[model samples]
Target: MLSQKDEWVVEELVPIREKVYQYLKNEILKGELKTGERLVERELADKLKISRTPIREALLRLESQGFVTTVPRKGVIVSQISLEQVLEVFSILSSLEVLAVQLATERLDEFMTKELDELIEETNRLLAGNEDEEISQFHIRINNFLYKAAKSPRLYEMLSDLVDYIRAFAHIGYEVPGRMREALHEHKDILQAMSERQIDKAMKMTQDHIENSRKAYIRTIDSVKKK
Candidate 1:
């Protein structure tokens, strides 16, 4: 995972407490706060120039989100992301993405296709750096577009939260050789099918795209364990 703490803490676009949560969660997801690392509230409060109440509240919320855990004496520690948990999350992700893409296909037009082409080009540039987490932002953007076009706000909301969980591990796939480029091509193919009004083909491509991503991420983790 790439560094996100600096980005999350900037300019105060959101509420103060929410900004604190975003900054800490960004640190956790980017592997800056390693699994089992105890989080110091006083230090965090001082670092962010806030009081302890909001920090405590943010930790509790992060705990509820499964990104951190309150240990017996270790306070809040970043949670471990297991392979089984990854599998479960990706299974849901694949299903929802396939549905969203299929629905989006029905709403496709020249304008949206042009927009997707632009997004694909942007992703291609990001892939040059192999910035998986940044590329995943585009993933979320595409999903939001698809869900909105699908007229499924609730589904998008669900996906929005689920995406946080997946982003924690998005970097793993990009570490594998050529995976970023392949993922970009997959997005292009899905968009092409959608533009052509081929719902069946788009759906199939979506499924294949997500499933391949999951496999790639898991394969990388397995290889690391072996090493």
Candidate 2:
């Protein structure tokens, strides 16, 4: 059963089914719903004070998104993040973000550069304060800032979806021991390359940053499994 804090309120604007789907997806992402945890429709319906139809719809949607699996006897269970999925997601992100950085190097305006600088400074502060979670959020902001500088809507949309998928499956890369500082240093290098309008260097740095992040996340997953 979901805790009272996790209960979904009936929102007026969104469709009930869509709201239900978002609620469930968020729970899975936040790890409130553990991997392989059984989700019985009747239980969810009773808990949410909603009908079974919407619960069923939401589960199906979550299944399609790789957030849950429908086991024969187990019903819907939260899906486990596999090694293959992690590697694949990082590979795609490396290619896509390299291109985004290349484009952004040529396109970043003064205001965009200022924003990136601000983000970098803020990340430095977060690091000094040992605010791990807030540092993770600044990483996202930095990526989004680069994507915006790329000025490619289609690329931005694709990257956004990939980012969400990766966040859902893999633990935050910065959480790995010593990775936070290293990642920030890499971010500074990438920003410097971009500031100098070195397109090729920026792209290569972006690729390297992502590869390092991939390694960090894999290490974290492996350590968890060992436990």
lDDT of 1 by residue, 1-227 (tens): 32344544436467667877877888877788887888899987766666888789899888887888888867788887778987888899889988888777787667777886777677567767866667666766776776666667888777766777887655577778878668777887887777678999989998998899898998898899999
Give each model's whole-structure lDDT. Answer: 0.78, 0.82
Candidate 1 has which clashing residue pairs, if any? Answer: none
- The C-alpha RMSD of each candidate to the native structure, in angstroms, is 4.2, 3.2
Candidate 2 residue 190 Cα shift, in angstroms, is: 2.2
Candidate with maximal lDDT: 2
User: Over the stretch 1-227, how does candidate 2's per-residue lDDT look in tens digits?
Assistant: 34563455566787789878878888877778888899999998888888899999999888876788988876789887778987998999999999999888888888888876776677667767876667677777888888888999999988876776777777566578889778877887888788878889989999999899899998887787899
Each prediction's TM-score versus the true structure = 0.81, 0.81
Q: Name the regions of candidate 1 deviating beyond 4 angstroms.
A: 1-13, 109-114, 120-144
RMSD of 1: 4.2
Name every residue pair that clashes in candidate 2: none
